[model samples]
Target: MEQSNTLLDVKKLEVSYGHVDALKGVDVTVNQGEIVVLIGANGAGKTTLLDTILGINTPRSGSIQYNGTDITGRSADINVREGLTIVPEGRGVFTSMTVTDNLLLGAHHNMHESSDKIERVYQWFPILKERSDQMAGTLSGGERQMLAIGRALMSAPRIILVDEPSIGLAPIIVNNIIEILVNLNKEGYTILLSEQNAYKALKIAHRGYVLETGQVVLSGTAEELLEDPAVKDAYLGA
Candidate 1:
């Protein structure tokens, strides 16, 4: 995709917590409607990068642009309202809240004005609709993962940043979540995904980046990454 069409752009991003630098001069980009995967081991700064992009953590130095507009140092609320949303690493649903209520929280800034969007979410995950009145904490792990992704969709995000979506779920459940993400991309939403399940993530992704210690060490098409011997040994368990 062309630079003009890039939906999310990061340049020389550097983030630090106290004296510990989580990200060091990292750069990444996600074009419109593309599914870009970021794969790496623990402490590779994947979460920090996503959080920085969404304005949760301040970057010591870097530039973030969304649709050509500089969004560095912006607030999380503003970013969400501007169509950048995240399905966090852990299923961040409110355990005490009903399924419906947890989903509604995604549209908090809009005062619940988008019921149609909620219906669309239900259409994507009918089980969520079936248990709309049930407490979120009562749902199974896979169900909670679905709810997390569904809640993110409630915001009508243009580009979603998903973190470790396959963590702690069974293989079948992981595949289900992957399919949902693929379908979402097909429907024109761009995604920047961070996953430890490199095989699955790369299979669906158009392109991928390999991060090591906060910097992009390798970046290529999904097929390229899949066949890379280094990637195979490190991430694919080959």
Candidate 2:
């Protein structure tokens, strides 16, 4: 990739809710075709950062640039149309809706093309096809995660902000999710993953940023982070 091939760039971001600051001057970048993971504990501002990037949460001060265009504080719908999408934490599927209907909802920006978009999502997740007519509330956690990802894929996103794919999943299911993310990255989808499962996140990430109390405490190539004593002690439980 060229030096200028940054797909998503966030600089000096700060976000607050009431009097509590959630993020403080954070900087992160995801290059084209790269899988960059953000590792942090709960309340460490991981979700806040992703939400800011997706425009679900507005930053108090910062710049978010996508494809070289300044998209800071744009509405989430407009940002999605610009080829940025998020598979939110807790696998935000519409529980009462059928799998197919939920997938169709993702194509709100291109409703007329929704039917055409679904087959691609089904191909990525065949189980969703089998459960197409079934209510999403009936699906397992793993299946729901798949549906969430598939729904995001319906938009044909350029950069995917995935928040904690491992939450509430069994080990095997987490592995499956990780493999799916790796496969998607191989297919050239840029991914920005926020994971509290630090060891696993670092293993799959090309590069990583470690956040603590709304500040970026550390950042490096994944290999460098994995071998760092501080990372091992704090996050890896080594």
Candidate 3:
């Protein structure tokens, strides 16, 4: 891919916790206006990679380039201001806060100037507006997921890293989440998605990577991966 079109690029990325290496020289990239998915089983280092990219976990080696600039080891807040945002696993909403408060928190960079963005998010997710005064903790699993995506959208980010968006929801809810993500990509949001639900994720992605034991085992277009025997056996229930 051309450098100018690459929105997020990670090469030889490595991360560790004490002696345990969570990521092992992984390489992944996302281009502008595309949905790139990283699919693997639990403990396949998907979340670690997302966390590393978001600057929540420091990489021990290699480079992370966002918009062609090295952002490796930058603070999470700094990355946030540079139009990189993450809808973390488990829908990390503030349980004690109201829906509006949680959505407003996403625009921390310039709170006073973010009303328009917040309104846009509300428009994308009218349920959030309806529950504006309700505590975020009370929303159902699907509603919480919508709130998480809406909160991420409130920042008007160019690229969003979404981890395990379908973790604990019903099949119908998973479909809803998948539709929202596909729609976001159609609206020109570059997405790097980490998901265990390979079938659904790959269906919406333009390209995909299969991560195993902290290393990337395969990379190709979504159709290629879907047709691969190993992928079909391991993830697609074929």
Candidate 4:
């Protein structure tokens, strides 16, 4: 795909924390309206890559381009305003705040009224609306995940970075969340999902990349990855 037409492009990206190198010359792209999944074991640098893309962690080298603009050193707040939002790992909701309050904060950068956006989020996750006045900390794991994704939608983002949406949930709840993400992608929301559940991630993804020790060791269409003997053995336990 051409760089100009891509929604996000990471070229030779590297990142480190102090003396520990996390991402090593990683490259990936998310086209408009596509679901791209990153699959790996724990400590494969998936979270580090997403954090770097969102400017939560600065890149040690290389460039990050979003919608044809360089956003390498942009702040997280600015990146969110510019339509890149992340529903981070651990369902990073503001536990101390009301569900409604958390959603409102997601739209802080927008100067216009957020009533419409709030309504849209509620429509996407009606359970959130039901628990609108409840403290975010009190919600169950699945509800918290919904609230997190709903909060990101409040920003009206064009692209969403989701890390481990299936973490710590029952199998049924994980399936529901994956279905919601697929539906969101169908509705033209570009997504880059980082996951440790390779089987589940491949089921909903259009394409996938497998990372090992900070390098992309395997990549292909989801169907291809699902059937590959190596992927099946290492990730799917087939």
Q: In model 1, what is the error at residue 62, expressed in angstroms?
A: 0.8
Clashing pairs in 1: none
Clashes of 2: 0
lDDT per residue for candidate 1 within 46-97, as digits (tens), equals 9999999999998999899999999999999999999999999988889999
TM-score: which is higher, 3 or 4? Answer: 3
- Give the number of colliding residue pairs in candidate 4: 0
lDDT string for model 3 (1-238, tens) is 3777988889999999999998999999899999999999899899999999989999999999999899999998999988999999999999899998998889887686677887888888888889999999999989999999998987779999999999999999999899999999999999999998898899989999999999999999999999999999999998
Question: Which parts of model 4 have CA positions greater than 4 angstroms off?
Answer: none
Whole-model lDDT, model 2: 0.94
Please list the C-alpha lDDT of all candidates, in the order they appear: 0.94, 0.94, 0.92, 0.92
Could you give candidate 4's per-residue lDDT for residues 1-238 as a string of tens digits? 3555699999988898898888889889888988999999999999999998998998989999999999998999999999999998999999999999999989999947698989988889999999999999999999999999998998989999999999899999999999999999988899999988889999989889999988888888999999999999999988
Per lDDT, the best of the predicted structures is 1
Candidate 2, residues 1-238, lDDT tens digits: the string is 5549999889999999999999999999889999999998899999999999999898999898999999999999999998999999999999999999999888878887788789888888999999999999999999999999999988889999999999999999999999999999999999999998999988999999999999999999999999999999999999
Deviation in Å, model 3, residue 153 alpha carbon: 0.8
Superposition TM-score, candidate 3 onto the true structure: 0.98
